[model samples]
Target: MEHLQPSLTIDFAQLSEAGRKDENQDTVGARFPEGPALATKGVAIAIADGVSSSSAARQASQTAVTAILTDYYATPDTWRTGQSASRVIHSINRYLWSQSQNNVRQEGYLTTLSLLVLKGDKLFTFHVGDSRIYRLRAGQLEQLTRDHNQRIDKNTTYLSRALGADLSLEIDMESLETERGDIYLLSTDGLHDFIDHRTLTEKLQSSSDLEALTHQLHQLALANGSQDNISVQIARVDDIGTPSESDAITVLSRLPFAPLLKTGQTLDGLTVEKILHESERSQVYLVKTVDGTPLVMKTPSVNYEDDAAYIERFVRESWIGSRLANRHVVRVVEPPQTRTCLYYLTEYIAGPTLTQVINERAPLPVSDAVELAEQLVMGIRALHRKDTLHQDLKPDNVVVGAQGICLVDFGSCWVAGIEEMASPIAADKILGTLNYSAPEYRYGGPTGQRSDQFSLAVLMYEMLTGKHPFGEAYGKAMSLPQFQKIKYRSALQFNPLVPVWMDRALEKALSIQPGQRYEVLSEWLQDLKRPNPNWLTNRHKPIMERHPEKVWKGLAFAGWAVAAGLLVFIATR
Candidate 1:
């Protein structure tokens, strides 16, 4: 039996014309991709209407439509529809606003935009200004967007919100469940403002041919005395093609996991040179191609063969690694040949793990620690730019090579795009090693870029002190109260060579509350390299708090001297 792959299918048509204006200031576009792109990115339809008051209105509308159509597909497939569309729209708005600012005539580039995306069994809508999106399902017509316009009088009105109207844009977005046979309509104000809702609904219900229907709507708008550029777009859902959890599992498990390999054994044109590491979840191998080019191959363990969630995560790790390109992050490589089993390869890094380095050379020099910190931040920032979070940041996941430091593990990464998609697999209750994880993960609080900052700070403290920032009790602290009881052991206490300002920076990054941490990783790195004037005020604190061990030793010496004086006095008597 041949299995058919699930996919989203749609039929759409669009038309834009100058009804009474000298030039058309409305734009409409639709993209229907096939195969994997259709399944991942779905179908997109956008409509934009330029405000007539602006001289650059046509350009603004065209740019808004074109930017969303092209850039939306360029985003990582892991991102959800809203996240991807919103990012592209915001960028377009910024460009249009800048152009308007530079215009000598001061006529702003402004337009209303409405975007509709059909993915899986859902419809996602992004709207700004007075452009409207309507859906007809089960013989009922419903408007999915609100007009962003304010009226000075019954006959005069202006758009209250629009792209390029301001430096920052606030777009209205919504998601609704979709059904096959549902019809969606997108129209500019020129058409919707002139045609009544009842007449539009009646026309939509009476037409089956989308191309003719859109043309009909345009002519009707002009007949109704519309004095602006007119535009209309119509799309009908042919198939929902919703992928169930089992479908995801089936797709991911097409290739079987490879058995544990021995040295000198060949599979798929690559020979296993040595086993690098093995755990209950996965196996890492040092492999060489037929040409003797060395690489590292990671394969899922057979222990999770029946676990769909585990299999999805294992495959996702490879997918994420292949997309990231950074000098400070390990590069996932393509296989030398077609693979017969489930496994992925990466460029071989010739260096010890950060953990191994610490074991051999604890208390790394301040300069070396600072340099490594900068590299790590660079790598993590790359992931952050793509809306990814490296949930785990520890010495074991970092390799110190001659090329510099490279973050190596992606199994624990969290991608915002993927999270937005519907999934049958439950998320892990806790991600990353408990010792380096932030408190939010344990307490079920929201986690974001700040969570990674907390983990990075822990790594920095360990590099300078050869110990965890919260001591041995941190890893065991499971509850909020337990975490609260655990206090930070400053790096200076273990290595006096660490600067006071640098230690203070580490303390701030390692704050138990995520809000207390630096707003960005770069700020923390800056504080580490330079002294913060505010931290200098700590010098005025009581000496005992700053140097408790020194104070205790001095007190012990004084007590011994007093005892000796008493003994001498008694002997003389």
Candidate 2:
């Protein structure tokens, strides 16, 4: 069906081999909402190795695929090609986590997951355990997802991470720029054991016909005497993509930028000092205007690197930052476009990274952390009013600048652009960081302002306690998808500097379950200002961050009170 874009051909096959001692555990790929075609812009493929050790492995396999497929189809159209597929899988994570929680018989019903989503040929992949995504480009196959279970020694395969075991699990997301003739082969470790990429590519060479090729590949896996549930999905790009609707929606406007006089290598009549930061994709420079006004100038990574897609994204981000014009956000100003580059000038920030500050002090003083957190919440409120979500909010991205605490790094910010950015697979990958990512992110689908709140809670938690709730358990810094349920009670006992009110407040803000987190940044800010001993932190722990009720429940209840007041006055008269 050639309506517009080039036709992308996909073929998938799954098999249960006799050597594994598992029959019903094997499952195959099909579009969710139960259909043959994926209407959503990308193709979803996965290889789930159900726990052969568990009794309910068969049912677990079915549940995992169903959850993953449902998430793929239900993805909000707002995501862009810039994010990851791990987010969609996270949506699936909650489902599997909750399902296993209820059924005791399904105890330890875990699986190794390798998920690949294809958008215009770009591959977004996430993996846990050993399932793999391999790309056959120019006769070479590159293994994209790193296996959780590394070979600790030559003889043994030790598990680092796997699905179903943890209350929540993490999946990896990385971009693979695919070409038109490129071949992508996704398989379970069962298939990888016998047929390496060279053999797989050669076997796939004869079958240009999608379904026939899938069948031949499955037969080859069986011929190698593979033991386990084996699955393979093949996709040939066939065509390249230009830009999504969101990509075109970048903000384009000229604002008050000092552009009065310029001979060359200068903007707004300033002398061109030198380039600040430039790569193949973009360039930034530290320069001064004629009067010695210092400014940081940024342009596309390079003329070629500053291709249509990258430039548009950078433009969108910079434009959003300019319009936000918030104290906590870095102010962006437009620069006169020269014949060579589309330039942007901004206030040169003077600040250290929160990460760096944390490094220097080991941990911040409690009062300072709370003071800075309040400032961040206010900044977040401003961002929400502008309908922007700072997708990659991490300690490094935030600045404890001369201006107090300012948020930076809008590079992965999520908001509607002149074009659409929310590609199906990238649903949650764009906004926020690991350890702090919302449950909705890992599970997949539309993550809006509430997702930002989840990240906010992480920051706030760090403020109240000298440590990150999730990052603390591991001796190392922290792992992505940290599963420790944050407890304010535990934190308060560990640190004497924390206030009782803050302990409860932080508990509410940093609830691992979205339902429990503060629904509105303002609500939390209000509570912060009031310093209430009886703040409803614990009572409202299980709130759906996306639950509209948090926004409207008060108004609806107030409406009822007004009506009741009128009725009582009439009755008294």
Candidate 3:
């Protein structure tokens, strides 16, 4: 719990009333998952309104609301907001439709369902039929979901899409970024249809207690002559628990910088043995504990002593490393007790960085390079699983130890939940090496797991061919036109040992557009080992398409030869 922070804290309330209807056919509920699930799955709120014409409408309303609220949490934490909620809605719709088919007299189970999931600082909305979800932010009321109803006249309308309306369901899903103090409202048609937007806005502004607001909305719906069951749910964002950038910078800046250590110099209980590495970023030293346990102590560069952002990044790097337990990631060791300075320690790996290895052994064996790439991808996959992007993924940030590959450097990491909070860090700033970074990162756009995959493929290309795909021009492009003009050189041109299929896979992963790359790191790793059949077709592509520069140069040479022959013929004449 000390290492991890809860991304969201919310207050929620739900109420359902029969109003003027003989039977209460509306259902509304909200639930916050416990412990780890709360952090991973967040909270879910749902409201459903049953159709008056169907005998099994009540069951459909209750079932739809219950199924989504419970099953949405059951989905894998790795799944994105849209995927998890959409899958649950589809499955519940199928069940409702099957029950309707089984009973002829009961007709079809029909209901309008609107569900909202608040995870971290994001809101996921899933809706079908006339029920609605709305959000109040910065004193403005915005309708977040669409009304799935067809109007024939002023007073006559029918639900166009609802649970069990047909064997197949069409659910409207959307995700919105959330801010602290944002209030969300989910309501059945009985409540939303009767209460106008102005009235709803007035009710929300008048109350601070969510329970009181829900009651007020229900009463107003009934007062306005709601003749059907009324149900409403209100959710207020209380807090996003992550620290702000300024707060983090302030806290980390207070720590004093560590002094350089000479061989055999003692600090606390660890004795420095040798200088491992040095850069403008930081210095690493090989050290030994009092009991002679080997370790690596990293101290921030003296140059950044007054730089708050740099200090904050260094501290965050240690925090991120401490949380990761993957074999291929460098392990950050916790201080035995309290530390005296800003430096952090890690379990030392007795090996050179991947950059050194690549330089020392150019054009590594095909199997060795592929195997190394697979291990490196595994490390990147581990970070991606936790919704973290190692923005600075390159050969220099990876170490080849006796055990295997170990990913280092988290100064440029972007954590999903943490980044959602108020931070001093600029989200749009380009991070990572230019040659390896994805094109999107260059333009100040959001980078995803795919961006990291781009970096990995670049490293793989370098390991195999000792050359960049687009050469130096790719990294120097300042505009979209310049970027688009950069050509990709085949790995086989540099090293003929690389298989055409493998080179094609690298080309796809190294696509200028992030969407053109592999969806997952594992997929690219698999392609490296076993060639994809789709890539086989790419091998037969025209020389101009596969290697544009080669064809262009050949055409230019032929044109020059023809021009020279014409000049000679004219001179002789």
| Highest-scoring model, lDDT | 1
**TM-score for all predictions?**
0.87, 0.45, 0.72
lDDT of 2 at 196: 64
Pitting candidate 1 against candidate 2, the one with the higher TM-score is 1
> Cα lDDT of all candidates, in order?
0.88, 0.61, 0.82
Can you give the lDDT of residue 472 in candidate 1?
Answer: 83
lDDT of 2 by residue, 243-355 (tens): 35343323221222223232246554545566644455555566776667676676554443324344445655665677676788878765544423355677767678777
Model 1's TM-score against the true structure: 0.87
Selected candidate, larger TM-score, 1 vs 3: 1
Q: Write the per-residue lDDT of candidate 1 for residues 152-214, one digit (tens) a residue.
A: 998999899999999999999999988999999999988999999899899999979999999
**Location of the lowest summed lDDT over 10 successive residues in candidate 3:** 421-430
**Ten residues in a row with the worst lDDT in model 1?**
1-10
Model 2 scores a TM of: 0.45
* Model 2 error, position 170 (Å): 2.1
Better of 2 and 3 by lDDT: 3
Q: For model 1, name the residue pairs that clash.
A: 79-417, 80-417
Candidate 1 Cα RMSD after full superposition onto the native fold (Å): 5.9
